[model samples]
Target: MTEKPVLDSRAKVIIAACEMIGENPASTLSVRTVAARAGVSMGSLRHHFPTQRALRDAVLRTIYDVATSDDEVIYDRSVAPRERLVHCLRQILAPQVGDEARRAWTTVFDAFIATEPTDETRAAYLTMAAEGTRRMEHWLTVLDEEGALVPGDVRQHANFLNAVVNGVSIERALPTETSVLERETATLYQAVDAVLRAVDQ
Candidate 1:
């Protein structure tokens, strides 16, 4: 496939809108604000995304892309599965996990879910999520064949791991009793390990 453009004109407007929304989560993201920030005319913005929902959907798709994209740098892959898993855990448990990044990223998603979302939005997000699940399943299948995983249906095992990772990430993102960065990730860590062990056994 050809390389993706840095950002299409429509995408630029959507990103600008997202930035505005980020400034104040409660602010209603209107097309005029986005057009000004994108340096595009309202007509131009509308040319690409004819309606408000169309623009919103575009922004949400961008969010899903950013969230699931292989943006993280993992230089070392020489380690065993368990050790590699630990590295992945640390990557996810980093301070930024539940920080502004998470909140800002989830804000649009929360809005999308507030009322009944369109079939398009659900498809976009769910497809992205399924991509993550597929990756997890691939990793687990490889490890299991290498005798790194405990045993059983590697696909199901991977799905379970995916569930734990997603749930913990969501929980950490909430306005919890304590901060995820300062407090220990021990409980969540143990919970993940236990689930993995169950898959092995």
Candidate 2:
């Protein structure tokens, strides 16, 4: 029997959208551009996503899956708990895991702030935030189960870590003297170290 293909045309379009966002987050995303990038026709893109909102939501969902997928984490029991925790947290900051989720976030936020924020747009923001929180909480829960977490609320710790990591991204967004990549990498390591120190009993 023949095996099935991994990504269908619709999925290809979605991936193209993500790559486009990564390439130029501020560019106005048009179906024609995305379809061309995916090597599909505009009709094919519309068949998959009838509206721009649907296409954007699909990209967000894909990003969430990429960032939160368990496969991203190393499951080696031999690795120390703190080491594993840092590795898992670093996945959130790396784009290779999903083309730098920060860019996708910036694109979404730009859309929200650049235009009149509507209830629907606000809802999308909340949905993405919840997904991120849930992913962070999962990693923290794993650490807590392994007895690596200190005496504190796991949810709060997750939120704190998320806040700090996002702060790094925010600061990097502004014009600065230092190289953004250098600053981002250094800040990511420091943030992870700080979180592990606080959480490791």
- Please, what are the lDDT tens digits per residue for candidate 2 over residues 1-201? 999888788989988988875676544457788899999889989998998768876786677677656543545557665667666666666653233454555676677777887665666566556667877787777766766666588788888888977776566455466566676666656655655545442
Model number with the top lDDT: 2
lDDT score, candidate 1, position 138: 55
Model 1: which residue pairs collide? 150-200
User: Which residue pairs come into collision in candidate 2?
Assistant: 95-100
Model 2: residues with Cα > 4 Å off, grouped in runs = 1-10, 16-58, 67-74, 96-109, 114-116, 177-201
Window of ten residues with lowest summed lDDT in model 2: 95-104
- C-alpha RMSD of candidate 1: 7.1
Residue range 96-167, candidate 1, lDDT tens digits = 455764774576566566757666556545554565665566556555665656657766766777677666
Q: Candidate 2 lDDT (Cα, whole model)? A: 0.69
Score every model by TM-score.
0.52, 0.60
The per-model lDDT (C-alpha) reads 0.61, 0.69
